[model samples]
Target: MLFVPLPFVNALLLALVFVFLKKSNGATATRAFLMLIALCCLQSIVLGLRWGYNVDALRFVQPLLAALLPPLAYESFRGLVDQAAPGRFRLAAAPLAALVILGLMLAAPILLDSALVLLFLAYAVALARIAWRGPDGLGLARLDEAAAAHRALWLAAFCLCLSALFDLVILFDFERSGGSHAAILVSNANIVSLLLIGLAARTAGHAQTETNTEPEPAPQTATSEDAEIVARVDALMTAQHLHRDDTLNLSRLARRAGLPARQLSQAINRVCDMNVSRYVNDFRIKDVCTLLRQDGITVTEAMYRAGFSTKSNFNREFLRVTGMTPDQWRKAESRDLEQKDRMAR
Candidate 1:
């Protein structure tokens, strides 16, 4: 009996919801979510192609797509933490390049098989890097709780690595394997990977909602020194436009503000009622609005100048903050500007 797991169907549904949430949120998250979805879609296509076509070329393409998935996902999560915009063409580069390379490699089965195996190995290494390093300056402390977003990613990474290992084993021992055993292992691994990814999507969605729902902590009394530090950081963010710096990280921001990174993070969290990423994103969002209103700059250029690395992220964050997409925001800004022009006339 050919059986597909029910969890996969549930995962697909949840992934769709994540896509909607990401699209609503507008920038890096959206791009990340889209990359995630694309990976899943390609994975599904590869499965169908393998069985239906029984082509070595399709087999070669599957692992390449699989290799590209984790890096794109990590990049997406990085965007979420920073709310930094992403480059459009740059975002497309990995998957596009992977496809092009895989297409070329298909001319020779021996070469294609070896290349595909190497790609999966590299993918495993990349996933390990992300898992080990964590995000931004945020630590594994956040993932201590079972419900944390990082836990889902950790689980997903584990599943992907395991799947890749099994794939390598199958490839190396293809001639020795019986059909039933190979089919069972492949099916089971696919189901496990799908389940983990679904959990990750759910976790991300829940984390976003939880963050929004949590009440702001009450303001506490600050010593004069603390107050001064807060004021300086805020002023630099607002007046000096320090957040516009792509290289502007907590350590640099702290150095610029003449404070320790820990103290700066505490000050921003306690005094400003936000994290560093949110703080920087607030400025980027403001710049996006200003550019939309001005009418001279293209949206892509605005996103770039505003320090966004991807359109999906920019769009997601813009919509989340302002309740409108960049296009919608631009149209509304243009209308207002036109109305003002009429009044001046």
Candidate 2:
């Protein structure tokens, strides 16, 4: 029997995501994200056909999807967060190359499952690393929104790991004529993962709207010149205390620093090893710490003064940067000061 509602709904939801994403504000990376989601949804259908319906003719779809997943995942991630992307056709060729690799898989069917599992685990680790660092690099966002975006990625990586587990289970089920539970679990997991991936694309994917107002500068090359750019940006940040603006964003910072957006982004990435959004938030975080050390200033007031829009945002960024909650950090500082006073006495 065909798995009608669930698999069909999964594909339909993925299609809707594709439609929305194509129209959404983003670049090559966004498109790659769409492709990644599409592949996942399609896998649900392919799996349904091969396993649920026992359609042996559609068996080829699995190897094709398997081959395309790893590169597409890595490329989508790079595009999502990087200042530059590979040439259009070059990026487009990844799946085609995967299709070409299918010949080797066909030649050695026994190695196919092992190789695919290894590739999935490798990309999952890479994705998790990028997520932990932050999603500020992926697109324009406020500090709070950037944290949410990165969390979306963390979830995506978790889902990918889950997908790999489901794959293994389905393989085992295929080997033993047993319960259909594994197939059901695999499809449902794909549905859940697709939903989260779509959320991440929405949360983090953005095209530069404000860039149209300014003359776009030529793309900066990777070179030592980035050092000077970073120094100048740092000076501007410190002198102006630009992070204190609650409305601060990459485009606005670029304007105030009198630098092209791309160059400024590159400088921040080079020197701070972070996206401009996170770099700015780091300043805000420091300011908050200083405020928290002072008496009579409430945490909410300090967070607001530091330019955070909400306490949740402040707490999330605080934990990520400081490894403690705002209240916990404040309490520790208070204890240290009390101990210092006793020593002075």
Candidate 3:
């Protein structure tokens, strides 16, 4: 039967994930993903034994595991991308565990089927929205080191979507025909989902385990250490005139100051009271101010020389820093000079 190969494939993937969990460093995200893989493997084993071998003992728990798939998949996605993701639903399992015992006792297959359909539909939509936003939407590290890891998150989103579709197929098939063919179909689908989810989990595990991205060097809180970091960044910016580069960004300043990009961003936000980009623009605006006071220098030239690439951004930053438009500031300075010359006459 087509169902014969399901258990073996699931078992193999289960063993790989078990090894992954045992050998690799224990990160929360990696652990959650491993749990997802383990759940998939168990789902495969249960579905295969129930339909393939006509075993009744594991049949009752199959739908319960089905109910778990959506939330578990979403949780795994959250773990792979963000370590701070909530596992509050894991607590819901205790009550669900009690219900699982009741389902086994009563053999209420309808309840399990209904739960699986609703849960998968809701969380599948949630995962799809996350995918729509891309890797940056997942809150991954904003560094080049995480480039390879972005693909993994994309794969994770794709796998979650496919898993949702697979659940719907299984649900529809089970409702229309509770025959041997349906069992074969369901068993085969579970096996396929297991393999796909295993790939996703493995990719996610690799991203989390690998130290490719810059680790967060400091906390978000305002600490006494921020003053020291801010001072160092200020010295570097002023000494090297780094604000003259139109392409300047947080990472470059962080590198120049010998601090982590996250720490540098946080220090600027805390000590200088603005984000890294705004703080840099403030410096650029100051340069623009100096150049504006001189004769024969147009506002456009002043803005370009101050490292601004676009007129709109230069105007925005100029207004934000000085509370006046570039032209307004220039005309005001000219008026002051005229008044001084008139007094001298």
TM-score top scorer:
2
Give lDDT per model, in order.
Answer: 0.57, 0.67, 0.64
Residue 126 lDDT (model 3): 66
Clashes of each: 20, 1, 0
Q: How well does model 2 score by local distance difference test?
A: 0.67
| Model 2: number of backbone collisions | 1
- TM per prediction: 0.49, 0.59, 0.53
* Best model number under lDDT: 2
lDDT rank order: 2, 3, 1
Can you give the lDDT of residue 171 in candidate 1?
65
Candidate 3 lDDT tens digits, 50-71: 8778788876677667667666
Candidate 3 regions with alpha-carbon error over 4 angstroms: 1-4, 21-29, 85-108, 139-161, 174-177, 209-345
Mark the regions of model 1 whose C-alpha exceeds 4 Å error after superposition: 1-29, 45-49, 52-61, 83-93, 100-104, 111-114, 131-147, 178-180, 205-263, 266-345
Deviation from native of the Cα of residue 298 in model 2, angstroms: 23
